[model samples]
Target: MKFLEKKVKSMEPIFAKGGKLEKLHYVYDGLATFLFTPATTTKRGAHIRDGVDLKRTMFIVVMALVPALLFGMYNTGHWHMVAESGNMDLPYLNDFGAKLLYGLIKVLPMVVVSYAVGLGVEFIFCTIKGHPIHEGFLVSGMLIPLVMPVEVPLWMVAVATIFAVVIGKEVFGGTGMNILNVALTARAFLFFAYPTSMSGDKVWMGGQEADGFSGATFLGDAASLVSDSPTVDGATGLMDKFSAMDSFIGIIPGSIGETSVIACLIGAVILIATGVGSLRVMLSFALGGLGMGYLFNLIGPGLGNEYMQIPAYMHLLVGGFAFGAIFMATDPVTAAQTATGKIWYGVFGGMLAVMIRVLNPAYPEGVMLAILFMNVMAPLIDHYVVQVNINRRLKRLKTA
Candidate 1:
């Protein structure tokens, strides 16, 4: 390690002002700092310094996401097997190792493509703009794959990554300057531009066809409940198919990384423990979702539909709701910054997500839209929160 450090230090001058690689100094510097903390320090005005830099924070997030990524890989293999054979024959598919290998085969490419294309764009931008590469994409690159369907094309992933980097991020001045989460932006771009690849029963699983399997996700089946077209493919009602326990364990077919409530919780624990994630946002976001789901349950029976009658807790268990609440909603760059504002940001994000899922049968997943909407509204939420604090303090001063 010391030898490698010396090697990096020795090469720094070559990328400096008048060296042969002067034009690419920022690129080299970015990579070097990522490998080793920047040796440069503030020599100017007073500044609060901490070792918990951007690279460390993003690394922590990627680490937190590991459980989901692992489980998603296994789940992808599980579902792909089901789709290929057109049956839920667990006994024949009990080879856990095979499932994981198959899943790894399917999921790893998406991850590689995501990072290769996203970081590639970031590198290009850093060179063109003559600025050091931002650490934000390290997390976004992982996130883009997690939110995507297992079968989304590699070319599509590349295009989406480029779109996210150029439109969703770079256009807004990159990283912290962006209004929406870059990952969700890529997913949204694909959702709108290539609905076939992003949605429908065929998108969730691998292979050319879903064979005899229904291939629809929990969210899709749940959404169908409102249309009075409930499916009983497994000889069980919608409620039975998505039994709370199954959803909690995340065996159901869904996006690459959003099936397991347990996995998301694992990530939540890691993020919260590290202090990288805001507990206020996560809690309020969940409470808000539960509140909305409970409301729907009360009124759903009157409408005579099972979808509306799903228990409030179920909303947290299925779809991307848990994943989004745990990972996406807590994004520091896009979420509310104030101590109190985080709560409101999370609550609204949660409520809106459930509302979109239940009310809009056409769109099964609502977390993406919900978080993006809240990202736009975060500043407004903070402004009111700040104003209230100011007014209350003024009232105390007047009383004195």
Candidate 2:
């Protein structure tokens, strides 16, 4: 390791200013920083210091996402095989290896495309600005693929990544300066620009082209039930089709990584345990969803409002609620920075997610929109929080 570090240092001069390969300094620095902890330190300053840098922090997030990512792959392959076999009850591709291989075939290409385009844009910007590349996109790149429909076109993925990196991050001064989560920005672009491809049951399942069981998401089913029947029986029947355990275990159809509550919980544990994520945001966001869902339940299923029948627990487990709360909303860059503000930010986002999902049947998934909306409001929430603290401190000084 010492020799490798020395070798990297030796080559650094070649990539330094005025060197022949100086143009690629960003690339060189990125690789070097990834392999070795930076040696330079503040000699004399009042700056707060920490052992963990941005690279290490981002790496932890990516590590936390692994459980969800792996499970998503298996789920993707499972859906594809389920589609191929045309049997929801019978297990398709009975072997785990086979399921994993199939998922890899479908999911890997999207991951590659996301990273390639996002990083390519970042490199271009860094080279033009003479700035080092920001490590923020490392998590966004993985997230873009996870939240997308399995059957979306590769070109669309590329376009979304370009939009997300350039408009979502770079336009706002990049990384921590961005107002919204970059990955969710890409998804928002897709959801709005290509609504047909991004939403609905047909797109959620991987191998829909090959017949098989084609059905709406749980939210989708509830939406349709409201349109079709207003009776309590219809509401009960709709809920019966979906088991809470299956939703928790993530056997249902949805986005690549969001279907499995168990997987998201595992990722959440990793994020919180490492202190990379916020428990305040996670818990508050969940509470908001539960509060909204329960409120809707009190309304009851009647007059074509079947979404009310879905239990609060179901709302938390299904769709991107858990995933977005744990991963997206907890993003240190885009989320509310003030400790108190984070609570407000999360609660509002969670409640709004359920509200949008229930009230606006046109958009079955609301986590994406809710988080993006809250991202824009995060600054305002923080401002109010800071002002309250300021007033309190001023009053104390007067008393003193």
Candidate 3:
């Protein structure tokens, strides 16, 4: 390890100013710094230093996401196998090693494709603009595949990666400057451009279409029951068959990572403990969803819509609500900057997510749209919060 570090240091001059390879300084610096601690430091400034640089910070987030990634892989494999064999109760599919292998085969290619295309575009931009490569894509690359359906074509994934990198991140001046989550941007692009592949029942669980296999996710089932007079007992009965425990454990069919509330919760704990994620956003987002879910429950039995009667607690368990709240909605760059603004941002996003999920049958899962919508509103939310503080200070000065 020390030998590699020394070798990188020895080549520094070649990539430094007036050196033979100075044209690719950004590339060299990125590689060298990524492997070793950067030699450069502030000579004079009021900077409060921390050991956690951008790379380390992003690395921690990636670590936090590992639980979801692992669980998603197993679930992906289990679903595909079940779909292929047409037997939901197959006990052999329960083996951890077999499930892991199954998931790895299906998911690895998507991950590789995402990183290759995304980083390729990122490298091109950085090399052209003479800017240091940002570590933002490290998280985005992993997230793109995690949030997508397993059956989405590799070509589609590549195209979405390009669109996300170029339009989502780079167009807004790259990385920290973007208004939307780059990963979700790829998903949104895919969702809008290829609705047939992105949504619907058949596209979710990867399998070579077999007899009597249904891929409809819990959210999809709930949406279909909207017109029926669904009672609490009826909703519970229906959900029980789907195995609520599996949803919590993330053994159900859905997006690779969104099915498991438990895995997302584990991620939330890591994010909060590490102080890398906003507790304010997460809490308020969950609260907002619960609030909306309860309101729906109140008005639901009166209405014939079974979707409305779904318990408020179930809202946290199903679809992308938990995953989005923990990861996507808490994105520091795109979320509200102010402490108070984060609260409102989360609250509004949460409410909107549930409202969309229940009211609009066209969109069964509302987390992506909700988070993106709030991303645009985050700046506005922070502005108001800052203005309110300024007004309070002004009033205090006037009274004094």
Candidate 4:
């Protein structure tokens, strides 16, 4: 460790000030700081120092997301085979090596494209500004690919990543200053700009779907429901086609990383335990979704709105609902800061998500919109929570 540190310091003089490489000091400093904690520290003034830094925090988040990423990869390969073979009854955890290999083949490139483009933009911006690169993209780069369909073009991924880093984030003054979640910003851009590619059954799986089974997502299929019937093609009903356990385990087709409720839950536990995420937000968000789904279920198969009959639990398990609740809504920068404010922020976000999914036919997934909307309102919610606290304290003082 000492030898490595000595070597790093020895090379530092060349990039210090007047060295030929001085022009790239930002790049050098960024790499150095990332490798080890900054040697410099505040000499004066009171400051609260913590054991962890931004890189470590982001690393923890990346670690938390690993389960979902791995599961999503396997699920992608599994579904592709199912779609191509046209057999719904194919055994799961079957041909484990083959499924994993297929998934890595499909998902790895998207991950690479996402990081390459997003980090490339970050590097350019940081170089132009003569500032060290921010560590925020560490998480965003991983996240952008996870929320996307497997078959989305690499060019689209590159374009969306560039948009997210440039327009969604850097334009607002980088990382911590951005208003919206960076990854979701990429997802939204692709969604609005290239609607057809993002939607339909074709995107979920790589190859063509067989005659009986369609690669359409559960939420997509549910959104198509018009009559009171649970069945889609008059064969097996929606619930029959996808079992509760399948949804929970994430065997069904959906976004790359969002299919597994179990994976999201594992991520949530890590975030909460590490104090990187707010428990209030995740819990309240799930409750809000369940509440909304329950309300629709009570309305009961009628008035040509059969999508409403989906069980409350199903809403949380399917689509991006659980994934959003755990990751997107709990974004430390965009989420409400106040404890009480987080509760309201989560509740409204979840309700809005389920509401949009059930009510709106054009869009099947509502988690993206819900979290984006809540991000805009988070500051307002925190302001009110702070104001109420101030008022109560002032009233007590006056009485005293």
Task: Evaluate residue 360 in candidate 1 and report its C-alpha lDDT on the 0 to 100 scale.
Answer: 82
Q: What is the C-alpha RMSD of each candidate to the true structure, in Å?
A: 3.1, 2.7, 2.5, 3.1
Q: For each candidate, what is the lDDT?
A: 0.85, 0.85, 0.85, 0.85
Off by over 4 Å in 3: 41-51, 225-227
lDDT by residue (tens digit), candidate 4, 1-400: 8888778878888877898787677677767877888875423211112556777788889998999999999998888888888887989878889989998998999999998888788878887897677778889999999999998999999999999999988898887788899999999999999998889888988655575667888878874533456422221367787878999999889989999999999999999998887899999999999999888777755445656767878889899998999988988888888899999999999999999988887886899999999999999999999999999999999999
Model 2, span 287-315: residue lDDT tens: 99999988887776564566766777789
- The TM-scores of all predictions, comma-separated, are 0.94, 0.93, 0.94, 0.93
On the 0 to 100 scale, the lDDT of residue 309 in model 1 is 59
Write model 3 residue lDDT over 1-400, tens digit each, in one string: 9998888889989988999988788878877877887776423211113656777777888998999999899888777777888787866346778878988998999999999999888878888999888778989999999999999999999999999999998998887889999999999999999999888777777864775667788888875543455565558645764666777777677899888898899999999998898899999999999999999988787667667877888888888999999999988899998889999999999999999888888888899999999999999999999999999999999999
Weakest ten-residue segment in model 2 by summed lDDT: 40-49
Candidate 1 accuracy as TM-score: 0.94
lDDT (10s digit) by residue, model 1, range 87-167: 765543487898899889999999999999998899899999987787799999999999999989999999999999999
Q: 298, model 1: CA deviation in Å?
A: 0.9
Candidate number that wins on lDDT, 1 or 2? 1
